[model samples]
Every structure is written in C-alpha cells, then in structure tokens.
Target: MRCLWDCWPMRLTIKSGIAALLLSTGLFGAASAAPAQVADMPPAGEGPRGTSQAVLGAERYDAIGYAVPYDGGANPGAISAAHPTLPIGSFAEVTAIDSGKTILVVIAEQGLATPDRIIALSPGALQLLGRPEAAALGVRVRRVNPLGADQQALRDGRPASARIDAPAVLLAALRKRLPAPPRSVSTAMPRPPRASNAAVNLGAGAGYPVPGRAAAPSVRPATSRQGTGFFVQVAALSNGQRASDLANSLAGSVMAGGGLYRVRLGPFPDQASADRARADAVQRGFGDARIIHE
Candidate 1:
C-alpha cells in the first residue's frame, strides 16, 4: 500500500504549488478592489467623507507634475481627463512641460491611484500633447470654466487665452467677499407739505405761509425801555426778516445788536408784568421766550 505521506521531494513540490496559488489569489483580490489603479470620482455633492472633500491638486492653481494616461471611453479623440480633485465637468488646459504642446480637456471623472501623479489624462489628451500614453510626461494644468471663452475656443479648435493675472484674480476674489456699499440718502426726496395750522398754536414757525393770515392789523407797538425795567425777549435771531415777522405778529420790536436781530416786548412795570408777558409769548409759539432787563 502507498503511504499517504509521500517522499520529501514530492511533498515540497505540493507545498510550493499551494503557496503560489494563495499568492495569486491575494494579488487578484487586491487588483479587483482598486482596479484601473483608480476609482471613478465620487458623484458631486457627496458629504465630506464621501466625495466633496476638495481637490487633490488644489494647492496649486497651475499644477506641474506627471500624468498617467488611460482610455476614457469609446471616443478615441475625446478631450477629457480625470483629476483627483477638480470639479467633474470643469475644463482644464493640459500642457507638456517639455514640448509646450497644450490641449484643453474636460474633467469627466476623478480619482488618482496616488498623490504623486497630479492628474490622469485620457490617451487622446496625451496624444494631443504629442506624448506617448505609456511613458511619463510632466505637464502643466491650468483650470478653466467651460462656460467662459474656453468653451468657444475649444469648439473652434483654438487655444484658450490665459486668464487674468494673479493680482487681478486676487482682487476679484476679495471683491466678492467684500460687504455691499451703503445706499445713498436721497437729497431729491420730496419734502412734506408745509403745516397750514397757525404757528401760535404750534411751537415754531414751520414752512409755508398763507399770505393774508399773518397780517395782525390790531397789533400794538412795543414801548421802548430806556435801559430800565424788565422785558419779555421773544427771540434773538440772525435773519432780519424772520425777526421782523415774529415782532409784528407778537406786538414786539426788532433791535439789531451783535450780529443778531433781537425781538422783544419791553418796558413792563415790574418782574411780575414781564413774567406774564413771557407766558403770552410762549402761548404765541415763542417757546424760548424769557425775561430780560436793561
């Protein structure tokens, strides 16, 4: 009968074969897990942990690095690329650092096998750059908006113009974050119609006057005080016309002194008489009226 335990040489051969089988299986599983060396970019708007963390090459607007070329889809002449962090539908101009050959490619998807390579371009894109799809080629990628002039340029088979300078881009970004300007207070706004009520009932003489209403035909003339007794001084004003109008209405006098037109009802017998006169002046809308003596 044959022994189940075979000779040492045969046993070693079987052991090696089993080991090789396990190794190949492990390799296949790892390959299947992250196949194509990259995963399709997570759909946009995924939570931070999901997809929308940010761009990988975002540190530099103009990224300079090597690109791995791969076939994107059926169209061999498709202008597309996969950037680890660029927005999926955005456009970029990829240029060969050495040859300076550039081609505008839309970022169709995302994911990069590693951070060492800045981007993964379609074989068609590399072809446009005049580089071999299999070899390493350093590139310069400038981000662009497809809605901008780049879209039309691509359609015309022309290159996109370089964007505004760094200072201009910085200024634009700052402007967007700045607070809105304060609205101007309008000087041309319409004024309220003048008060039609008698100012004697109100306080001050506000705007607008009906012509005949202010004529006081029975008003008394002011008695001149020869630097004696107290007087009820209605107002001290700069405008002669305004002072004169107030004096005429209150049966007072306008005396000009020290750059002011003084309106006063004067020559009262005593302090009590002056006090009564002051109260009358207040009732007639001279709220600032007070007793004064010469």
Candidate 2:
C-alpha cells in the first residue's frame, strides 16, 4: 500500500546490500578455492622448490690420477702437497697404486698445479710414501677431515702429520703389488656353473678348458692394483676379532675396510681351488657366499 516513489529508495538500498553480500562471498570463495586446489597438486620436477636438482643429479666424483715428485720449493721438510681437486688447507690420503703404501699429506697449494697428475708431493712426502723417485706414480687421492689437534700439527709441518699405520687386517693388502698366479683347471670335477653372464679369461691368451663344451665368450682377465686373488667372501661383520676368528677357522684372510671387517676364504693359488672352496662354503650354510674374482 506504500507509494512507489516513497518505497523506491528502500528497495534499492536492500538490493544494493544483498549484492554487496554476494560479491564479498564470491571473492572469499575464489581466494579459498585457489589455495585448496594448489595444496592438492604436488609441485613438478625432480624435487620440490629450492632443491636445485642439478646437485642431486650430479655424479659422484672419483679421482684417479698420478703422483709426481716435487722438490720442496719454500718448505723442503714440510709434509705438504700440491693437488688439483682437493682444497687448500685440507688433508688427503695419497695411496700408491703399485706399492699399496698410503700416506696422509696436507694440501698447501692448489689450482691448475697438477696438470695430468692428481697430486705433487714434497720430496720428503714422496719419500715417506716410498715413491721419492717415481715421476708418474699412479695414485688415488682420498679426502679426509683431520682432527683439530692433527690439523694444528699439520699446519706446523710436522712429520707426525704424515704418519699413519695400516690396520693389521689390512697389512697384507698394503704390501707391494704382485701379478696374479696362473690359473689351472682340474679335470677331476665336472664343469661348475658360471656365477655371472660375463666370461672369464685367464691371462697369457689362455682360453676356457672345457672339452666338447663351447667356451664362454672370452673377456679380459680382471686386474687388481693391490692384487687380490680369487677368494670366497663369507661375511662382513662389525667385530674385527670375530672376523679374525672366522678367518682362522677356515684358513681365510680378514680384510678391514669401509668400517667393517670382511672374512674371506682362500687367496687360493688358482680359480678351481676357489670354486671348490665356494661350493663348500655354500654347503656349510653360507647362502650368500660367492667368489670375489675382482
């Protein structure tokens, strides 16, 4: 019953309020919906943001090069070295590939210092490593973090900084490298199963010896820097004494490395002997026993 003109403003105000309410609700819904959708979808790429996928995908660095003798330039008696990859002020383990002798040396210099070589040690350092006259001694340099006290000693250029004693278990391995002995097959036993698809070749151009059986694909014999002959790997245990005990029982050898003690059987003179030993080990409840030809 209200007059149209008197009611027009009121009706317009109500409509405007309703519209404002709808607009606010729509904007709120839109903002909330976008975040929810984003939460459901994982970010793309090899990893999430800030991961810098390149670092995660990069290959591990394996340093293999030569160690050359260097006359002490400014510090003749200092046990120091010039390296290519190791940072200055850091310590490294330089091992002779042929002699298996290992020594710790400080990195006093760096840069393009060693062109093709991995490290250039001082004359004293080289002598300590027992490679004083070696021009291009094949070496593998391993990085190590020295103790704070040792770091101070190394900084002072003390000989003790370079002194290191090989573990008893690793003593034999640290000796001079030798060529592997000849492998002879025993005709007494039937041909054993191949452990791998890859063929094994004896050096001196020797071929497989099975009669009436097709020889396996010929592959080059494996070479070892420290010359570890064929052996059966029994187990890697935490206790070195336990490994020693096992080794004693089986006439095996205990090799300590990588924070574990390895119990191995037979650096047998030949492969046939190792195979027989491996078969025996498998029969003796070592389900994981396998010949380590490498």
Candidate 3:
C-alpha cells in the first residue's frame, strides 16, 4: 500500500533588533540581575534539578519575536526550542491564542540573532499547544521546580504543584493564561494500533535471535513502510504541479505518481543513509530536506 505524505513549510521571521540587544546587554547576564537566592528558589526536593517557575506575557523585542526556520522537520515529541537568553533545556509554558490549552516545553535550540524575541519554541511545542499555524504567541517563563515532572503531571492528571514547590499559585496563574485548542482537520488516514511486545522483540532481533532454534516467528500481517525518513512539508501549495516545480528547483527527485508530489532525497535502502543525505541537503541550502522512506 502507498501513502501520500504532505510536508508543511514553516516560515520564520526573526526580530533582529532584539537579537542585538540580547547579545550586547546580555539579557541573561547574572550581573545585570541578582542571582536567584536559595530562599527564592523552589522548596528543596520539590521539582527536578534546574527547574524554575515561568510566566507568559506579551512583549516585543525587535521586529518579529519568534523565528521558525525550516531546519529539517520538527518532531512533535521533543521539547526543544530557540531562545535568546534562557539556556538550552530550560522549560517554559506556551499558550495558544485560539486554544485555551497550555503546554510546558523545554528550550532546544539557539534562535536567530536577528529577531528580538524572548524565546522560540520547537515545532513540537507548537503542535502540543495546538497552534502549529501561529508564527508568534504569548509565552511565560516561570521558575519550574522539577523539569519534566510538571509535564508528567499534565499527562497523568496529577497536580503539577504536588510534584513541585508551588502548586496552587502556579496552577491558578496557568488557568488564566491557557489558550483554546485549535480546530481539527479532516483526513482519510486512520490512526494505527499500539505496538505489541512479541512483534517488537522480533523486529529488535532483526530476523535472528539465540543460537538455538527459537520458536517459529509469528506470521504477522505485513505493515506499510513509513518511508526511510520523515519530513513535514512547510510550503503551502495549491496543487501537486506547484509542489513538483518547487521540488525540481531544489534538485530533489519528484515522486508525483501518487497524486501528491513528494520531494525526496534518495532510494536509500536504509534509514541511516537517508539521514546522511538529509544532512548534506541542509548544508547545501535545502534546509527543509527531509527523509521519507518508500
């Protein structure tokens, strides 16, 4: 069976003025701001190491506050970001304007110095907040206690405060700042069932196991390959022809036989080869090149 994959193009606009100020004034400088005293920190053993409270509000830096460069496809599971001052791995709360939902994300990458925004979230962060279309949004950087604990609390229905030092206060503040969820899009694709353990082990062993004859492998139904590499299309094209044209310009071989024109990297027999190709493409200016396996 064949599947049509759509890559979404992301347009990033950086606020250059803010980038200059952050570099020159050192907005994150410890000397400019008093070092957070132990008393001001969360209670001991409350949150994960390096966690702190954060707040989300509107503030203008340079021209654009956030930049979403299409540096390959963004993963929806990772909590990465680009920030001007907050160190990588720092956590923050991102709220959407359309949805009243809020998600905590971690800083993953360094943002462009051109845009003067406080922080730029990873593509995964935008998806979690249900605002993948939004170019900019309000964010609050609070001092979180434990880094990943609050995320777990949100997922498991436990109170974030219970795992951290400040529960009541932070929850109350977040409730007011959260954004509403985005409208759902209709697609023919159906979600796949969860994976099973026996099947998992067989794949993990790669058609070989212990020296002795293992139990006969189960005859599981064949599954569709999810391409060797994955990429999110960032451009908005009205038709496959336009997509094909763009793909050709990028020197990407087109796979348009299936109605969807896919700009692909290779007939790579394995994922590692595709990954290397993707890296090479990025260096050559096709920063959006992604791996999709046949």
Highest TM-score, which number?
Answer: 2
What Cα-based lDDT does every candidate model obtain? 0.51, 0.52, 0.39
- Candidate 3 lDDT over 1-294, as tens digits, reads 443433222111234555666778767465767765644323322322234343334232212122231221234345545454444344554433233354555544333333223444544555655555554454444334344666565333232332222245433444354343212212221212222211111222121111111233332332232244444222222133454455455544433211112345445677777677777777776554555443
Candidate 1 per-residue lDDT over residues 175-265, each given as its tens digit: 3333322122122322122222111212243322211112232222333433567877776543456666877777777654322345778
lDDT of 2 by residue, 16-129 (tens): 888889788786356666753433212222111121122233332234455555444346477787655555566766656565566667776432233345566777777777
On a 0 to 100 scale, what is the lDDT of residue 266 in model 2? 61
Which one wins by lDDT: 1 or 3?
A: 1
Best model per lDDT = 2
In angstroms, how far off is 81's CA in candidate 2? 0.8
Residue 158 of model 3 has an lDDT of: 32
The lowest-lDDT stretch of 10 consecutive residues in candidate 2 is 46-55
- Which has the higher TM-score value, candidate number 1 or candidate number 3? 1
Q: Give stretches of model 3 more than 4 Å off.
A: 1-166, 178-242, 251-262, 270-276, 288-294
Q: After aligning candidate 1 to the native by TM-score, how far in Å is the CA of 232 from where it should be?
A: 92
Show the colliding residue pairs in model 2.
none
User: Candidates' TM-scores?
Assistant: 0.31, 0.35, 0.29
Per-residue error for 252 in candidate 2, Å, reads: 63
Candidates 1 and 2 compared: the better one by TM-score is: 2
Candidate 1's clash total is 1
